[model samples]
Target: MAKTYKDVKIPEELFFNIKNFIEKYSELGFRSVSEFVNSSARNEMERIEDRKRNE
Candidate 1:
């Protein structure tokens, strides 16, 4: 099942950067920026968890 989220407000420059990054990735088939970011965050978090476990 899918989940819903609240909207976040960001500065124009930051939002534009995200827009451009997502556009570049869209050519590789990601559906949206949020999907891309969520996956990216999950990967980073897992990496951090691994390091913590090792420590």
Candidate 2:
């Protein structure tokens, strides 16, 4: 089966900021703003789950 994706809307200013940051720090390996956001969101979710388990 093929995977489907959906769009998540963010403010234009924030998008531009992320784009600039990615361009400045190309070593981070983020191909696009979406990749950065997806990784960030996954990390945060894992952190929150760990905290809840600890508590």
Which candidate number would show the highest TM-score if scored against the true structure?
A: 2
Question: What is the overall TM-score of model 1 with all chains considered together?
Answer: 0.63
TM-score versus the correct structure, for each prediction: 0.63, 0.93
lDDT of 2 by residue, 1-55 (tens): 9989999999999999999999999999999999999999999999999999999
The models' CA-based lDDT, in order, is 0.78, 0.98
| lDDT per residue (tens digit) for residues 3-39 in model 1 | 7788766688876787788887678666776677677
Q: What is candidate 2's TM-score against the reference?
A: 0.93
Q: Provide the clash count, candidate 1.
A: 0
Superposition error at 16 for model 2 (Å): 0.6
**Clash pairs (backbone) in predicted model 2:** none
